[model samples]
Target chain A: MKTVKAFAPATVANVSCGFDILGFAIEGMGDIVQLNEKESPGLEVSSISGDDGKLPLDAAKNTCAVAIQAMVEDLGINPGISIQLEKGLPLGSGMGSSAASAVAALIAANEFLSSPYEKKDLLPFAIAAEKIACGAGHADNVAPSLLGGFVLIRDYHPLDVIKLNVPQDLYCTLLHPHFELKTADSRSVLREAIPLKHATIQSGNVAGLIAGLYEEDYELISRSLRDVIAEPYRAVLIPGFYEVREAVKGAGALGMGISGSGPTLFCLSKGKEKAIQIAKAAEEVYQSIGLGVDVYFSAINTDGGYVLTE
Target chain B: MKTVKAFAPATVANVSCGFDILGFAIEGMGDIVQLNEKESPGLEVSSISGDDGKLPLDAAKNTCAVAIQAMVEDLGINPGISIQLEKGLPLGSGMGSSAASAVAALIAANEFLSSPYEKKDLLPFAIAAEKIACGAGHADNVAPSLLGGFVLIRDYHPLDVIKLNVPQDLYCTLLHPHFELKTADSRSVLREAIPLKHATIQSGNVAGLIAGLYEEDYELISRSLRDVIAEPYRAVLIPGFYEVREAVKGAGALGMGISGSGPTLFCLSKGKEKAIQIAKAAEEVYQSIGLGVDVYFSAINTDGGYVLTE
Candidate 1:
């Protein structure tokens, strides 16, 4: 049997003003999936680890297996494969944990089958995995984690995804405070209707952020990275969020916002050293409140998911 | 007396997906303002023409005088300036008629004072002009007309304006039907609240448009040039709005939307010739309904307001 190991980085969705539409991948931390080719014509889960026994061992119920199943079905070729899962990212830390797993598995499976699909072609399979894990097939996390850099989901119905320009010096500090906020619960706190004025303000900020990124204007990005729609209501759900935000701003962070759906927060900075400094500042705020926190500092992941050789 | 004449191009505001925040200036059509230096202390409106006696001749009530007054007040040096207003743009045509007048007046006045401020510095005075012409002091029209390109009013509180990059081959076809839609009356049709889904969709499209413009992707721009919030309600106010849109699309227009408010519409195209074709197609729609229409074909006005040699 031939075995291939693959890795896909975790991602931050929403990116402040671009809620439900924008996301980007981070380096150094992600999920790893190992796939082994077998002679039998079916899929199976060999083992799972690093999830504290929280993930299912059943292949039919797992995110990686589900994604590979969809891919192989679409290709009309059922290759016998066994998937091994290792969760480097927390399950619901607002850091695209399931998406990373599905992406990693698909990458390894495609390599095991001698590469039949391109990187972008793997998006729909990862999105299928998201449907079962998060109850909605959103591609904000999946697209970025699959293709790398910043990704914009322009429309969901037609699945229009655009890869945006990433600034050369941009770095991110992700603070995962020890708690999980369910995506569904985070969504429930929002009102069905928002003020027309707030909507216009949010769109203006979105345009500004996109322009800022392309022009490499950090100050403009700082001014435009605001969430008028989601943060006001979701802030109360995370304790000490405002305090940490103030500390991050004081630490020379460009901008700070809740990463995806809560508990986890991201601070954008100009360089790697600044990102490290921001991470330390954020850690201190959580430590003062007697809460444990995990910190990750990374420039953007430009290569996305890739195979690894033993 | 040292006399100076200036012309400022009219602008198209609310360019499809970017309602209230995005606008671009058009070439060829504008208002002219002539300022004559006099040996007096205060401002005076000497004569007005081309308005059919509809515009006020009072220096305090006219848009041009109000803008110059604010500029002189800010400069703290009251130059005796006799203003002559020529209304080349029609009133309430949704083609930024008032903005052009204010910008042209400011350009002429600035030249009359031997240029005290940069072009961008004149935005506040133009905004003050908008307050008297319309109920609100919005800069979507004023900024573009003054800056001479696609401008994004990122935020209004501190008055942040960003001039965006324009695609070189982009052209516009503006159709002004024989009617008037007051800015206040057009605004009254909208609701104070909108669905959260609609807001997200709008922000997504705004991001797409900004990215598309920067990347020069005509197809992406076409997909993003859709207005969901205001157009649904405001479209009914324009006669044969849907019919014109369909015809414009059939003529290979990239996109079409209400320019500023109503009574005038804009269709974007790849080049000047395509714009002319789209204009003819749109004219057919209005002509079949027994409505008279005026057509203007222009590339983007890159040089906004400028002093003209008489």
Candidate 2:
């Protein structure tokens, strides 16, 4: 075998108040992308899996291809590669499946070529690929994947990335129902105008949440994570939002919010015990609704995106 | 000289994105409230300066009186005192003169009474006083003065306060143009609704700025502090905000924003040299506009409100 393959975990974007700027990489999810260094000069995508038999293998229009070419062009490495993708995450699930593919392929290619680009440098490549998937350039999913942990993109130009230390006790229980929700479509249902009062309240929560993160005060963190603006408007799209939140909140979760654009509900807890409880509660809600549930009780992935089994 | 006196600096509330929650204590640029302990009951505020006209000697009406009474009540100590108010900071200049007087009086009273109330207990008393001044309750000024650093207020119930480690290199140059803009009146001009686009973009900035604060990145901090939402609307109240920002930006300052409200512009810089330069630039701009300017260049007062002199 001329090349090896690896998987990138799915990520939850918007992580509460940080829409289009905050995201967390999840474990046990997402797609696997492969890299093959052949005698041929060009790189091509060979096979694909999961994705319900949909996603293109064009290798150019594909999100994974864009990230690979960015590395190939910059490093000037002539490795003929036929990449195969295993799209484990649902397409358009608001779980950053496309971004995972792009990031995984980029990580694999960069690692195979001896890592010519640093993690943060993957932003441009990720954004470019994400633009094709979302019709606009956004950094929410890509940044968390490439750099891992919680990242803040201060300046997209010089690429000022701040890597925040996730509190050690944070555990997330993400439940994605058997429904698909496109980020663009979900965003369209939002209000064109939000009342100033709601905005002010939301801003207070944002500040409070940041303060909570800094202090590592779990109670305050839970209280400050309340959303009065976007979640209310967007939660209407997710059928089980209310039930899942109520269930998890009763099951010893700190707080919960719609991850990214929705259908996926995420709850934070103090430990694996609480995480499992929340996950169990979430699965019950989904089961009651007669829908499939994929739940994971993983801590935040500290190392966002990197080469696996290298 | 049986009693001691000192001035607590006026503060700028809602420092950018931290509305109704964040504040910064400004030194040598607020009201001077000197307290005299008397062997009498209740509180008496007699000495008043700066304003030529009578300011009503009613103890309840006076900001210092309200703050002192609140502190005494909260501390469960009924100590008679006389507050001498020499209003150094201009009223309605968006410099939090009322808050300063309250804080200064509280500090003096607490110290004079053998310090029954600790620093942690100052926020409630200060906020109660601010309620009388602004006709509402907020701890922006009082918290910073009491905490003596950049504070993040998570919740008002349990009163979780987090003191952030502000970068040592960060300095603020405030140019106070001799003008008045009431905080209440300025707050009334906000539109009832904000576009969702603006809210999400602001969310991104909030995330980036908070993350930047933790990382202690000055450049990223400045970049993330950009306020496109509130600043645009509030700039209308302050004449030449655009001009001051442009002038200071050209002078190598990182960023500028309305300090609390209108008239006082705070430009942030990394070093003292740049701070001095920015100060000179702001002064020139104010002078060119035929407005008197008082410039103060100091670091982000990490030690907020404490016993400066005995």
Candidate 3:
């Protein structure tokens, strides 16, 4: 194939109780990448849009280029490729911007090379790219972006990934404030150690959330949506976090928590109507505080990253 | 309704990955309690056996009597009932002896009163009794014993319990070394604080195990059966734990870990034959070290507590 284009959905990581282990892909917001064949025998970032000149243009520093580079090395193929990145999502908004770009590039490169790898096989490349953005190779965002739906990273060493069931009626509402919380800065606020009591409760909530998803128990999910480790430490960094959470809860949200590393807060609801109401309520909290917020409503994306044409 | 008898199965709490939250019921070992009505209008431990005169006879001090007393107070039905306890499981064997006794008495008393409560409704009484045995009111042991099969105690306060799925072919092998590790002492060895990295991994394993159970994915369950918080500190208390674990793993057991705060070690395998092999392997490890061990092989107990008719 001379060229391939792919789109990867945005992902919500942590999922309240699961911290670094769980996440889910969402529709309506994502990134797209196009790869065109070239004779130079290496990848290059030829063009980019939607990022407002914030993202790096150099191939080695860009998330999409890094993932494509990793994929090329792994496959032992040095075919030249020119890339174009469409950044539809905001950076550092906690909506997994880097992960979407990385995943989309990997999928596009795989398609252009005649599909040599499975979707899951591309996880390491995406995670490696994510590590360049953040210090750790966490799969919470990349796994869901690559595999679709709800995904759990069971272990980091062996890179074990499990796809969890998502309730059909579940909807996600994200409110991204016009601000940024760099992944590194967001991570710096967390404590290196935690009390055993808090750890046990967090573990229980993780188990409960997984159980709730499998059983489609909305109340259980709501009750289990607590983050003792990260949320308490990072909530102060986000504007109107507590008020937005309270407003979403009052609007019939099943649960609400900071979406990736923050500057964006997400709420889960049982239906689109409730999700819309939650979005409105959350927007009002930000508006009253004299801050601009972008609201998006979407369901769990069953498909992660895919080639637009073969 | 003059006389009622019931049996509560032994439980393996913590279940490696889910310390303080997960547990499962086992067959072949349990405690039996018989309750008979009297005219005194209060509860009493009229008789006891199999404990070698170690347990307290006072209703307030005895685990069985404490649970019965709580149930009586909650129901507001004060009737003189004498309990005859049959302690089939050894105390401090890490097989949930106290939990079994408490659950058995609660079931017998409930049955004698014409079944005033469901099995799950009696959880608090059993947990309260457990607190008297150990300093904490943890339901890991009690929930599985009362509700049957695998149970996850999502939260202790406002007590939320979720019954998890058990694979049909799964078998358990338990080896009780003739040594005691008091629950208080076993728990005392754990560090009050844990590194955040370890806590994150533990949370991941708990989520993975739950997903494994839901999908009946034995490998996932085995892969996720790791205890980074408790077992590392408590392993030294159990004699030959390391050797036994290695032997069980060599014998093709799916996973093995300390059962509760244990001198008892439990192994999971896919069939009775493999469970038997694992038990034999574990027995050799103990026997070679000149220590006697009591081994039991059983599947997950589907019936938690049951009444006996006379």
Candidate 4:
């Protein structure tokens, strides 16, 4: 194959109850990357768009380039490639922007090289790229963005992941309040230690959330959608978070919480109508606080990342 | 009905990864309670057996009596009842002895009153009784003992529970080391706070364990069966625990850990044959330490508590 173009969906991690373990891909919001073969013996970022000139042009420093470099090294095939990055998602909006870019580039590169790796096999490279972008190797965001549906990171050391079931009727509503909250800053607000009591309750909720997904019990999911670990600490960073949460709850959202690390708040609902209603309610809260919000309604993306053309 | 008898099986709480949230019922060990109607309107403990006089006979102090009393109050039926307690499980062996007794009494009382409550509706009464026995109203032990199979206590305040699936081929081997570790003392050894790093890993494992049960993935279950919260602190209380764990692991056991709170160590295996082998191996470790041990082999009990006769 001379060239490959791919789109990778945005993902919401933490999922309220499952901090650093659970996440799901969403449709409609994502990043696109294109890889073209070059006669020169080096990879290059030929052009970039839609990132407001914020992302680095240096290939080594870019997430997409970093992921592609790892893939090239692992495959032991140094194919010269020129890349184009089209950023469809906002940076630091907690919608996994860097992950989408990294996953898209790795997938595109894998396709251009005649597919030496499986979809899941590219996870390590994507995670490595994520570390370069965010200074941590968390799979919660990248796994779902790469593998789609709902992904649970069972263990990090051995890179264990399980694809969990998402109810067909479930829909997601995300409101990105036109602002940025760096992943590092959001993480810094959290406590290094937590009470054993809170830890136990959080653990119970994680188990409950998984059970709820398996059983397809919406009520169980709603009841278990609570973050005893991070939400309490990070809530201060997101403006009007509590007001938006209450508004979405009143509009019949199954659950509502920070989407990834914040600036974006997400609500899960049983149907598209309720999801849209939740988004509207949340948008009103953001507007009341004089914050411009971009709202998106989507269903769970079953396909994590895919090539536009083979 | 003039007389009613019931048996509630022993339970293994914590389940290695789910401290204070997950538990499963085990066959072959439990407590049996008999409820006999009296002409007068009062509750009383008529007799006791199999406990060697270590249990309290006072209705308010005894687990069985306390459970029956709560059931009576909840049902608003003041019928006189005399109870006979038959304790088949050892006390403070981490086999959920008090939970079995409490569940048995509530089930017996419910049966004597002609099934005034559904099987799960009696959970609160049993948990209330557990509070009297263990100084806290935790349902991990009681839920599995009462509802059968595996149960996850999702929330404690409103008492939410989700019954999880267990693979049919899975078997359990339990070794009671002829020693007592009081629940209070077992709890005291734990720190009031835990590092966030450990807590996050523990949470991931809880989600992994639940996913393992749902997918019927034995390897996932084994890999996820780690207790970062409780086992490390409580391992010292159980004599020869480390040696027996190694022994069981060498005998093809998937994973091994404290059953509930020390003295009793349990191993999980894929079949009854392996379970028995693991038990024998664990027994040798105890014997080498000059300690007597009683071993039991069981599958996950599907029936938590059952009436002797319908």
Best DockQ among the predictions, by candidate number: 3
By lDDT, the candidates rank as 1, 3, 4, 2
- Per residue, candidate 2 scores C-alpha lDDT tens digits across B1-310 of 4575767776666666655556676545656667776788789987899956446568998888898888778677787788888888777676676777778787877787878877677778778887888787677677776666676665566676767667777777888887777776677876778897667666556656565667777776677767656788888888778888899998888788777766677777888899999989888888888878888887766665545365
Report backbone clashes per prediction.
Answer: 0, 2, 0, 1
Instruction: List the candidates ranked by DockQ, beginning with the highest.
Output: 3, 1, 4, 2
Q: What is the DockQ of candidate 1?
A: 0.92
Off by over 4 Å in 3: none
Candidate 3 local Cα displacement, residue A55, angstroms? 1.3
Regarding lDDT, does 1 or 4 come out ahead? 1
Query: Candidate 3, residue B11: CA error in Å?
Result: 0.3
Interface RMSD of each: 0.5, 2.6, 0.5, 0.7
| lDDT score for residue A96 of model 2 | 81
Task: Find the 10 residues in a row with the least total lDDT in model 3 chain A.
Answer: A130-139
Binned by DockQ into CAPRI classes (incorrect, acceptable, medium, high), candidate 2 is medium
lDDT of 1 by residue, B146-208 (tens): 999899999999999998989999999999999877777789999899999999999989999
TM-score of 2: 0.91
What fraction of the native alpha-carbon contacts across the interface, defined at 8 angstroms, is recovered by model 4? 0.93
lDDT winner between candidates 1 and 2: 1
Off by over 4 Å in 2: A37-43, A69-80, A112-114, A155-160, B1-6, B37-40, B72-79, B112-116, B154-160, B307-310
